[model samples]
Target: MIEQVTVTPIAPPPAVPRASTWAAELRATFTLAWPLVIAQLAQNALTTTDVIMTGWLGPEFLAAGTLASTFLMPFLVGGMGIVGAVAPLVAQARGARDIKAVRRVVRQGMWASIVIAALLVPILWQIKPIFAALGQNPDTTLMAEQYIQIGVWMLFPALAIIALRSLLSAFDSTRIILLITIGGVLFNALVNYALIFGNFGFPRLELRGSAVATVLTNLLMFGLMLTYVLRHRRFKRFNIMIRFWKPDWPRFREIFRIGTPIGLTVLSEVGLFTAAALLMGLLGTDEIAAHAVALQCASMAFMVPLGLGTAATVRVGVAYGRKDAEGVRKAGWTAFALGTGFMTLTCILFLTAGPLIVSWFLDPRSPANANALGLAATFLVVAGFFQIVDGAQVVAAHALRGLSDTKVPMIMAIIGYWFIGLPIAYVLGLVLDWRGVGIWLGLAAGLGIVAVVLVARFAMRKRLGLMAGLG
Candidate 1:
């Protein structure tokens, strides 16, 4: 009895000050998102700078670079989507405080990148002949080939960097990605000036120079990101170099299972735009130029919500991992609201300042200026409606991805874009002769359908306890 009286109870650990649920989510999302937004803006600015500097050389240079970029975009964009599979997986692991799983996911993602790059290089190498066969002008074909040859070589390093960056983003270390990206863009700008113009004793490579600059910048970014990851204390013990090289079968299967649908979903949507551009090219150079300008403007606007969508992925992933159904619901709705509000503001700007915006990309006195401005303005008006829907769809898609329900979204995209959007665009633009505007209407329909479907999917997943394993 005297010995038993000696026992004493220990106090429990103090509870974390509960962050205001909505406010916490917003803060976390923005903390992760703003850096990405800045990085995207910087990247866009660098591209704009390249175009501006190249514009001095004449329209042929601009056209050549545009064609090259367009040809290469599906791979780059689709690869980015494929690599995106790492983020939600790692984010969930982080929420569960399972650093080992996060490390495994990163390693698997690198392996996926290698596989994707291997497949991409040969296909991209052969695309020049395809473009030529498609009836591009000889001069445009030659320039595009030259540029794409160099650009394709960058895919390996770019994919690697993307994989690493996705892992870091899942850990909420977005600032590192931002810093590296901005630095890379700055370096690219300098290199572009030196290479494109034959400055500082460099050879006058012109468009070829642009490709080289882009490749060099990508290499630099990859090197820096790798170095940073290796030195990071949390990651230093993982031995990712060996692990990634070894290829864990289980992790690879999981990534491929989740990643393929995402890849196809992105490919379908991006392919739609690429197809539209190609069809527009058939109309004439002026139409192509106008479409390019309008697309560039729309892409820039799309990035804002894309950043928000990425943030939503992390938010939803963490919430799901914590087994907080309410938190997941709130995260999705909050992301939607934020994305819609930002897009609405952009819509107003596009409506009121469409001409001014178009002028930034084209010289008002040029031969194609009128066509570019008029079509760009029309595209912007249509984009105003679609951008909001686009934002909603992307955010909803990410929310579902956090729940690991990628297949449904992928199927929806296939139906919405291929079965619905492409047919409508072809009929309205080619058969009915509505041209560029008709193509845009088709895009709007597909995106609107996707938006509705994705939201519905997320709701269903929530009701079904998709995050059951998260707890």
Candidate 2:
């Protein structure tokens, strides 16, 4: 009795983490990434349909449309990046089992999106003058302006959709995202067909009609997404919009804090590519066409990594929130493995099927297309080498994003893309007279360097204090 009174029960050793195995992690990463990958493809399809319809109007319309997109995408992407901060924040909150925090984050994210849209819409609305200042073809600029004036309204719904998608993604509800996007693609096609050519008694608005179709399609998609989130039993309980007007200044600021760097990072990369395009323009029409074809192939392959990277953000984020250091490592490396592995296949495809892929984009039998086809096939070979690095860098960056790391990555991107990559391209393509091959080499070098640094940053995260938040 005395011993019982004096003795305390021995505490059990801290339970092991039951860390997920690589096979399990791989399966989890794949499950999360596939829907996102398909969704990305569908989103790209939406744009492809628009381009195809615009081309039907004439090259002038196509050029105008392209110009509008080039100008519009930076703003749209930047804003979306800002709102994209919601994904990691939500994932972290869910991992921590902090339901209230989740709702607050989603709400603040929507508020942030609205504010961003308000600021950007007006700027995009004045597309005419901006194009004028850039000395774009006046008629083309005017036509682009028509499209922008109507289509710019899409900024609101697009950003809103991105924010909501973050919530869906955290819950493993991404299949709906794929469904909505596919539906939007089909809807966009039908509407474009009807309105652009006045096929179904719709007005022959041409470029403007495409713009109208875009606005309508976005609005419809946003509506459907909103409805699902509000009605779905799992999501509705969050009451994400219960106090839509309530202010969460700290959370609002947090989004911008985490997001601004991402926006700038994106702009930097896009600028580099846009500059590369400009450089290609100097070579000749065939070079530009070939570059476009090769770039498109590279871009499609990129969607896989991009989707995997996004999944990494969610997985790593949940681990980060739980203070599970090992989980974070596992999630990150698993995603890296999946992304780079897929890219390896694409690299092989590009290397082995360069000519065949080019054939899909351009007729190999056409005498006029021979030069473009040959050059595109050559560029694809170079694209093959860069694909692996491209996959590595993007997934690494997004994995860091799970740690709420951005500013450093943005700096890295700026240095790698602008300073290192751009100069190399200029010299190799122009100064050294390497032309398109030189330019592709520069791109590969830039991506490789960025991949190296980013992967290192992730590996050294513990020592660098990036994981100081771990509980």
Candidate 3:
């Protein structure tokens, strides 16, 4: 027996687990975020072009355009937010490798988009009286009404783009989305230039030209995106449009269930800004025009975070679907980091170069533009102060959205924006006679409040049971 003793072979060492690093997470987040950022910037450039051209027409046209946007954006953003649910839904489906679910959700999203646009378009048609009811300037209201009447046609296509873009984003085909949007920007500029100034043998349409250009650009974008989605090998396999007229009531309702709160969440924040525009209107035309210029600058910078936020929604949604809590955490915090970092750069630019940036919107040398330009520069400085909070809040809200958490954030938005932010704006701007600067400070306060609450909520997700079901 002693001579027959056998030697035991050495056991293989246990496999070492690969840990995720901040560098890897950052690279992954940036890869997903960059295309979206470019797409968002290009999309915003469409509006910026309209703003630049309208500003060239004079302060009145600029004021009218701002008023029109104030009315239109709430409707558009709310509807788009509803449809935006498609993104996280599709993202989760992909994570689970449920291709059929992806098709069903996207189809229903299209149906939802159509229905939302149809209902909202009519309401948007009544902008004149609505503005009047809100006590906006009569002249500006009339002009805005004209612009909206023509621009309303863009809604159907616009909402459609959101649904389609949601699909593309889920598939990580956002490069095409960026290209298509860039094309829309170029086309919008050319059409606006030709029709606005009556160049290239086209009759001048002025504000109406901008409206027509907007409609055409949206249609072109929708067409191009639809074509790509239908033909692209990566996406065509899903056959998203196979049963075009079929009803999927549950998915459609699910879109609204998850989305209505999202829409209202958007309405809450955008509505706050719109109300601020109305407040500026009360101050005077120059105030409103200046607000428009400064707001556009802020909005342009905002697109970066907005795009990053969207990417976070998809990334975190995928991770959540896979029940990978660590992945979700990495994806989410990475987005917050990138978004806030970019916003820091923008904050410095706005603070240091406020006057120069304002001049790009209005001719600094012109006596007519002097007052508006000065006000715009001042507003930009104020906008700079809120940049970090603004970026953080939007990204945090989107991170929650990835977890399919909408209702609470919606409530938070209402409390922060409407309940807290608006009252401060009214008191400081009106009651205290702080006027324009006061209004901006109030906006900053609201954004800061929401940011704190949202960031806190996200940070405490696991401890608060938000990640209970997730691994």
Candidate 4:
């Protein structure tokens, strides 16, 4: 009775909004995306450097690197796709302020990446025999085998790095990834010098040396990223490091639920391209060589929008977390606009300076260069048309990912690539004898169709309130 007059303290209210949600979404999207874009650019530069250095060895070495990369690519690219499953999931968890779910996702993603690397390494290791069975030249096969074997070892580290990057991206800390990628590229260049040419008192290993350099650099990157994440104050708060060491079955299952379809979707697209290369090889070495050059160039261009797409996912995820459907729509459209603008500019550059660009990797003055350059130029021109559409599609896909609708996009990709795209490419490239250009045209068709369908699906979902809680 005597203490009845005691007063209870009231808690302060949450901070009021400072800006329009659309404005906030735009700022956050760029803040998250620019670093990722820079990181992607650096990674591409690393591969470009490898190609440039190998170009010095002669066409056979360059061709071997290209072939080996294409064959080994599904492991790395496809694995990254699987890891990509983590981002949207983490993003949504972050939005919900569910610290537990976030930590669980990080751990499960690490495990999934390990499994992916394990399954892929053996398949890549035995690729030499497969190439031989496919009638690849003995010289190309020998060089490719050496490169593939060493490169395959790097898959473990690459997968780890990819897993780390995806988690970081979800947290909107892309600067860390950018910094590490820049370091990796520089390290790769130095290692390549020492290993490829026997510098620094090391034995010259040539092509195999290049592979060794790549493996060492990737391992270094993974170590550095892991160390940084563990020590960083920001990341430590989320227990990303701790949870990564402990297995969480429920979280792992959630990751698989979201990730498997994405992995298969990516696998299907990459498989189609790989199949195209194999079929092109059947046509002749020159065709294969030309295809390799064009493919490399296109891959480089594709990374720009790919980075944008990553940013789009983060933006959409953040918006979804805020439970703002309108914000999500605005962010998605803004990303599409930015991506399309960048890719359209790229198209103009490719049209005007394609020959110059191809010459950087392939010497037109060389006797074997004429055909390759000529065909590459043609492919680049055709590639120009699709780049914008490709960017749009990727951004749209990311929007869907933010909505946690991975299954739908996966289905669309499967239909777009296999049911629609690959058949068209085969008919044109092989049956009608349109060659590499034909294959590219088919790719354009598939990507365009995907762009339309995915964007429409996202629109429908938003309009129908299907994305209410997913915000």
- All models: lDDT? 0.77, 0.83, 0.89, 0.78
Q: Residues 423-447, candidate 1: write the lDDT tens digits.
A: 8988998999999888888888888
Quote model 3's TM-score: 0.95
lDDT by residue (62-96, candidate 2, tens digit) is: 55776677678889888988999999888877666
Q: Write model 4 residue lDDT over 1-471, tens digit each, in one string.
A: 000111232231222122266667667667778888888889987888788788777767877887788798766877887778778776666655566666667778888888888988888988778999988787888889889878888888887787788778877678889999999999999989888889999999989999998999899999999988888976776566663467677767766777777777777778778877777776666667677766777778778778888888776776676576776787788788878889999889888888888788777888877887787788888888888888888888888787777887889899998899889998998899898888888888888888899888877985655575443
Candidate 1 TM-score, true structure as reference: 0.92
Off by over 4 Å in 2: 1-19, 56-61, 126-140, 281-289, 362-375, 433-437, 469-471
Compute the lDDT for candidate 3.
Answer: 0.89
* Residue 401 accuracy (lDDT) in model 2: 91
RMSD of candidates 1 onward, in order: 6.5, 6.8, 8.6, 6.2
Q: Which TM-score value belongs to model 2?
A: 0.89
The list of candidate 4 runs beyond 4 A from truth reads 1-23, 243-245, 463-465, 468-471
Winner by lDDT: 3
Q: Is candidate 2 or candidate 4 better by TM-score?
A: 4
